[model samples]
Target chain A: MAEEMKVIYERPRSWANKVTHYCPGCTHGVAHRLVAELVDEMGLLDKTIAVWPVGCAVLGYEYFTFDSVEAAHGRAPAMATGIKVTNPDNFVFTYQGDGDLASIGMAEIVHAAARGWPITVIFINNGNYGMTGGQMAPTTLLGQKTTTSPLGRTPQTNGFPIRVAEMLAQLDGPAYIARVSLDSPVNIRKAKSAMRKAFNAQVRGIGFSMVECLSTCPTNWKLTPVESMERIRKEVMPYFPLGEFKVAQGVL
Target chain B: MSDKVLMKGAEALAEGAIQAGCRFYFGYPITPQNETPEYMSRRLPEVGGRFVQAESEVASINMVYGAACAGVRVMTSSSSPGISLMQEGISYISGSNVPCVVMNAMRGGPGLGNIAPAQADYFQAVKGGGNGDYKRIVLAPSSIQEGVDLFVDAFELADKYRMVVMVIVDGLIGQMMEPVEFKTKVDVSTLKTPEWATVGRHGRDHANVITSLTLDAAGLEKWNLKLQAKYAQVERSESRIEEYQMDDADYAIIAYGTMARIAKTTVRVARAKGIKLGLLRPITVWPFPAKQLQAYAPKLKGALTVELAYRQLFEDVQLALCGKIPLGWFGRGGGVVPGPQEILAAFEEQFGKGR
Candidate 1:
């Protein structure tokens, strides 16, 4: 009898391994896997509660092995803040994209951080909007062509991309803030680690924690899935650098 | 069994929450329902409670969302514009399935219409104000007494169903004070909150998730169906209506919350004028008493709806009547109240033939 070979990079049983509704080559699948991995690694499979955003990955709840909720546009942080505060025992995280986090939800995110609510926020900073037909996001890079930005982003009119990690790093309440990209395996590892660290900080009774992942959107970027991965490394990384933007020393 | 206190329709609602062991109150100051948070601010602090006057309407509702997640009894008050601003947060709470009481002291509006009483926000209160498919259990208070009664009912329904309960009142009803008594005192704080409450993760094994997102069309469908079931259950179990004089009358009026109060006064005046009018006031508009109203539809001549708006709830009365019964309406905007006499005139014009 021939020896059976172990499976390669297939769905992890702990992740429910169901087919995701994502368009080909979307990095949200990768980000979601990393989170499910951490939930399993930390033995939070049954206990983890995730708040999903109202963007491309809105059905993020279906891809996971744990409990999830869909928040209104720009209100993931507020909803997660509620879940974390009310059910302080659960592992709470909000998976939000650029438009949901930076554009409409600016008020909720700022105040949740300012109040030092103990929670974790996973912000996926793709350059343009994804779910609502690729409108320009607050994090849209200069000269990025999107449905809303037909002539590329104009600094004179649309303003520059927002560095959310940098902006949030200055806040006194946020316990951890890291910005990482999902361009390659090595960076994906770093992004995954950043997410674990932020969640672990909240688990330790630390204050608001966030990990900003520079993700990819092939459909919106008008690139193939392969090219989408390539752009993250070749173009996107050059603009949004990878690093640990903030950490509350001795707190975690 | 607690001591009785004289209160306004609005104060009765606030005191009812207090008596029910409510502990958190967050809201923006709008006219009409200002007494709710004002009473909560002073009263909550005295009884180990928390009251926060939020920076804006948005902040206040979100703050309630935050506190409720922590397993506390939380609520907020707002008028029309402020309530509209709170739609985002209210949607969040509904999606999350976090229970909290939202008091809408409705005034006239499309845009800051008036400070006069109006029930124009019928669509907003019943339909999930924010995006996504959901509904709130809208409790309409018809009297100074029912104002207090609905708060207790709201907390019960909010907790029972694990959804947002709107104690929708109008300006005139909220601002007016009257004597009311609790037939029975309920120890609201003693009622055990669900294990899902996120008070603290310490020494716990379960991590609860309270959210409204269902990423896939199928997954979203599952959640929506579940919500519909809950709403159906609410409709079957919690819907309420008050029938003041439907025994021999040909026409009945269908109104709720503050509109019902003005409607009642209109009913009395219209009746005295030899119009055999009876009031069919709905206490809860969301799980609307459609079945009850439909029973009277075949026999009714017409229905008069006295709301605080021009076009707000006229449609609902029409919907309940289902084109089988003709519907008439009367009202004002902002906080301008509908005079009982004006409503009576509209009633006479619309249904005078029956008399």
Candidate 2:
């Protein structure tokens, strides 16, 4: 008789079966997988409308098996609010990069959160603009060298790095605000859990929710995937601490 | 008999949008068009719709884009400078091939020129303001009644063509009060959702993705070809013009929007003086009633173009007439609106005293 075997793991149902365009060691694929997993686990595949930002994940819509719209650079939050408000019963979310959300789209993100629009945001902060090739971003660490900030970022010129999670947490609108890193297996699982909680806030119609994923851009960082993970632990984490910044009442 | 009520142009235009089944309105405040958002803020909730006062015109147009992608009737209104901020979002919406209505209540501008009425944005509206090879159906309304009436056509054309449809009115029309009637009331419940909307998959076999990005050069060229085809179809079928008193006329004045309304008085005055002057008003400025103007070129001895801005409308008139008739141009910029007598005097100066 043939041996009885069962599949232990496989791709998430909501994940599209296609090769990704992300550079090797980039955590955008990981972030996409987490979102896809949540879409499948929560049975929201059919009811999910994603607003993809104009950055590395600009074509993120192609990697997911759900309705999606592409927003102009930095306008994802506003676009997502438009979608959520008009289609109140549908689940809406925005996937953005640090440059897209924390820099050019600052006003959009702040206002969307302040309006308490019940939408989820998955922000991938890799310290620099990845798509445009290693330019300085609003979240670029101090002393980090980017093409735009070749020598190093300085307070007098380039300004200080923005801590978006802590800043948004101060607002009354957001029901949940959390920051997690994708530097390790344990933190990856934690990031997934935090994303679930953020989605729960929206599912329960509490208010706005966001999960900031401190990710890696190996190509831009000029480091191997392993060294990038280590840098997140020793460097990025000190500046952008990981933890839930806000959790509204009744959110698990 | 249709019930008519005295209404401010901006408020009437807002109510017209509501009547056309536009359930979502996103806008930021600006001069000559503030009443639109104010009216929508109060009236949308009553109609089971949504209204958002965005942080800026940039956000407002993006919100309009999002709602439009959800396959719903949505709109935004702004003045000159504010509309400039919306150009990027408008380009994205057009490139993505979604449907939405945008209103520009023209204010003077080279830069924050003034709050007074002006038509300097003619090139921006009928021509290109945003990036890429895109065209928006621009309807120029000469009166509050016409502005209200065009709102229905604006929304319908937007949906029909799956592109942006802009209704351009000057501050004069936007702020002035006139008797208007709500001629058409579209039942929002009857509006069918388009297949391309990104509202959610629901039970569909595949998800819809709305994007304007085509990275491949050949692929983008093919998309451009498709858009050009659609624009050609619109140009063939949608160009509109009103020929006022042109029969047996020796001279004509070509104008649009508020300028057209003021020029109508010039036509009457010139005819009273037996000058045989008439008016050719382009109702749809883009797709530009060029053919209609050409049809009159053979009969007209001279055509004078008048506007609230310098040489903008005259350029299109010149292109249409193509030097077949003696062309004359007159305009006042920086918020200066020429009176009927001044227009008549300019007409005589350009085309001579009488027929």
Candidate 3:
């Protein structure tokens, strides 16, 4: 008789065996694992409820073994509001992409933040709309080329990308709001830590906690994974600086 | 002991919610229904309940979504325009199968039509008000008393069916103040709730999965079957109707909400002139009290249906008859509530034509 050996980098217990449908080099796969690892670590494996908004991450329900609900396009915050308010005992969080949160869903997220709902939000701002194909996002960089902006995004006809973390940080309700990135190994570690801190904030009922990560999509960006990560480091971080934008005392 | 008070229909619903153990209300002010939230703001705190004025109807319904998940009876109110904005959230609640009340004191609209009473939302309300194949247990209340009692019933139905319950009324009911008796007072402290509530993992089982999506087709179909079964039970156990003056009647009138009360008055007036007319008023808009109407339909010469809107409720009455009896419909829209006098004239015309 033999017993299987335990492993660290093995698949997380809270995430299913479904191979991530994310394009190669898409950091959503990495981001998801980080969240699942934290849920497993904090013993919230049984009680965590994650909301997946309609975007590149709409299929997030398939990846997480923890219970997940898919909200309508731009309605994740509202859906999360329902779940969190009704079951405040469970750790509730929303995983939203750039367009889902910063653009069409701005009303929902802003209002949720203002109310100080005790929930966690992991926002992956990948600069362009991925699922609907390459399109300008609220976080899309100036002069970025996309299907919607063939020539390039111009200031007169198209608006500039939004800095969501810094904007939300100035609000009073969020206990923590940080800008993290996945462009490098050091930043990846920081991103996971920031996510853990946000979930921990929800655990303490401190208020809303959000970490907006600057991620990249190689398939949509028309680049290889290596090139995409490099572009994110050099191009995205210049506008959306990574740091702790706001924090409530004693939340961490 | 029932305590009596005179309150606006909108105000009555708010007070009834408080009495029904509701401690949180989130809503945006809209015409013909602003009193509900305004009252909650003043009264919820008195009862140690929470009342939040959301940024918009979209936010308000979501606020209720949050509060309802916390295991409390919660609600939001808006007129046509605001309610339209809330349709997406209402769909979310239905899909997730959350228990909460949404009061649409309907005003005229395909858009923001007017602040006056209208029954134009009947199709929207009884037909799930949003996407997905589901239905809200729609209760169309006719007066201030029904406004209060219907909300009480709505909460119970919401919890029972585990779906959204709509206290479907209009501006006329929302604004009119009438005497109402509170038959019961809710003490939330005495109630037991599902452990799935998101009140923070305290003394409970693992967090309940309160979502509507099951990506697997078979799983979603199974959930749908369960929901459909629950709705069937409501049709069997909770269907209601009020009949008036049907003895030896030759022609019957089918109506609901304010239109039914108005029809009752019309029947009484027509009775004085010696017309053998009856009234069939539906209480549960979805189950529709169809069998009762069908029973009357075969025996009567004809039936006339009335509503504030053109033809929504009339369709239901017709289906009830299943072509066993002749049916006629007359309604007005755009801020006008049908009066008994006009209805009486239509009844005479309908009766004569059928005879």
Candidate 4:
């Protein structure tokens, strides 16, 4: 008989087999994997409807096996709310970038959270507009240089970075709000756990839930993938502290 | 005995939508159309429907987009300025090929001109207001009763073509009250959820994904061509016009919405004064009554286009009967409503004072 070798690990069932358009070592792929894994692990592959934002992840619908819709830039939260309210039994979530969510989509996100629409939001903050070729974003830190901020951002010129999680946690609508990073394997596990709780919040029909992933963008940051991870660990993590900001009772 | 009830135009249109099986309404309050959202807020919940007063017209249309993607009957109402804000979402909905209804209570425009009634958004509605080569089926209702009746056709046409069906009326129609009978009550329970709706995968072999982004040039071109073909079919089959007293008429006055309603009185006035004038009102403005107007070009000496905006409706008449007939134009802007007698005066002035 042949050697009784068995597969130890396999790809998540909810993840599609298509190759992603993300650049090498881009954390968007990592974030996508985490979402797909949770969608599979939580048995939400069939009922989940992903609202893809108008950014690098505009084509995010392709990465998942579940149903999806593409929303206009910064309107993903409103669109996801539309999907959730009309089909209350279906699971709806939006995947957005910092510029898409924290910049142009501020009102939509704020109002959606305030309305307490039971929807999950996976916000990827990399301090720049990655799809539009690295412009300074609302989440861009002071003294960080982007294509739009060649001399480094200053509060006098570019407004200070927004702490989206902390701000959203102030709202009474969100049942869970957390900030996590994808810098290391340990932190990646933590990010995944936070994502699970956020999903669980929606699954339990608690309220609005969000996980702001402090991700890296090697191409936009003009740094090596290793340096990007280090930058998140040293710089991004300080401004956007990693931890749960709001947790409703019984949202484990 | 008739069962018609006296209802405000905005409230009647809302009830018409509910009767037409539209269970999802998302809109922001705007002048001349605020009663629509207010009525929907109370009515939708009573009928086991959903109502969302969005933060802005942008959010409202996006919510409409979202509900439409889930393959349900959804709608939104706004005036000129608010409708301008909705153009982006409308374009996305058109590009994504989802079905929804939108109502525009025409008001003075260019920018927040006034809350008074005007038909300045003709180009914005009948013509392509949003980017790209997309078309919306625009229904111009001239009266409160007609506006209420058109809501049924609006939702039906939206679902039939998977395109946006706009019911356009002047602010007067939105604010006015008239005896209206809800002739059609579309049992919402009979409506089937579309197969393309992004509700969930269920047990399907493939998941449904609704998007308008076609990265490849050839793919986008293909999509555009497909949309153009659908528009061509709509234009060929769906053009609607009402010819009021056109038989043996020496002149015709072409108009729509409130302008056409006044033009009907103008027709009676001009005929009484022996001008033999008739009114040609376009009910479906986008799939414009071009062919109907073209047919009358040979019979009439001339046709005068009247509107609430300067030369907006005339542009379409010019395009349709440019060389075939002598075309005349008369309009007022900035919330000016010309009386029937004034329109008759303009018609006589343009058509050489009594043929």
Tell me the whole-model lDDT of each prediction, alpha carbons only.
0.78, 0.94, 0.82, 0.93
Worst 10 residues of 4 chain A by lDDT: A1-10
Better model by TM-score: candidate 1 vs candidate 2: 2
Candidate DockQ scores, in order? 0.23, 0.92, 0.37, 0.91
Name the regions of candidate 2 deviating beyond 4 angstroms.
A1-6
Candidate 1 lDDT, A7-27, residue by residue in tens: 656555447667988888899
Better of 1 and 3 by TM-score: 3
TM-score of chain A of each: 0.93, 0.98, 0.96, 0.97
- Return the lDDT, model 1, position B93: 83
Candidate 4, which CAPRI tier?
Answer: high
Measured with DockQ on alpha carbons, how good is candidate 2? 0.92
Candidate 3 per-residue C-alpha lDDT over B1-355 given as tens digits, one digit per residue, 9 for 90 to 100: 4868788778888998888878778888788888888999999989977777777788777667666665678888888888788888788777877789888888887786888888899888886567787877888877888777777788888887777888888878888889899887877888776666555444343434456667789998998898788878878888788888887788888888888888889888888887888888888888778887877765788889898888899878877885798788889898787789899887677667334
Ranking by TM-score: 2, 4, 3, 1
Residue by residue across B1-355, what tens digits does model 4's lDDT show? Answer: 1389999999999999998899999999899999999999999999999999999999999999999999999999999999999999999999999999999988997797998889899899988788888999999989888887889999999999999999998778888899999888899889999999999998988999999899999999999999999999999999999999999898899999999999999998888788889989999999998999998888999999999998998999999999998889999999999999999888878888758
Instruction: Put down candidate 4 lDDT per residue, A35-135, tens digits, no spaces.
Output: 99899989998899999999999999998999999999999999998999899988899999999999999999999989887999999999999999999
In the range B186-293, model 1's lDDT, one tens digit per residue, is 665566756876443344554445555545799878877888899889888887889977898888776666666667787787677777888888888888888888
Q: Which docking class does model 2 fall in?
A: high
Give the alpha carbon lDDT tens digit for every residue of B1-355 in model 2: 2699999999999999999889999999999899999999999999999999999999999999999999999999999999999999999999999999999999999898899999999999988899999999999999988988899999999999999999999789988899999999999899999999998999999999999999999999999999999999999999999999999788999999999999999999988898999999999998899999999988889999999999998999988896699999999999999999999999888878957
- TM-score for each prediction? 0.81, 0.99, 0.91, 0.99
Question: Alpha-carbon error at B117 in model 1, in Å?
Answer: 2.0
- Per-residue lDDT tens digits for candidate 3, residues A151-175, read 8888888988899888888899999
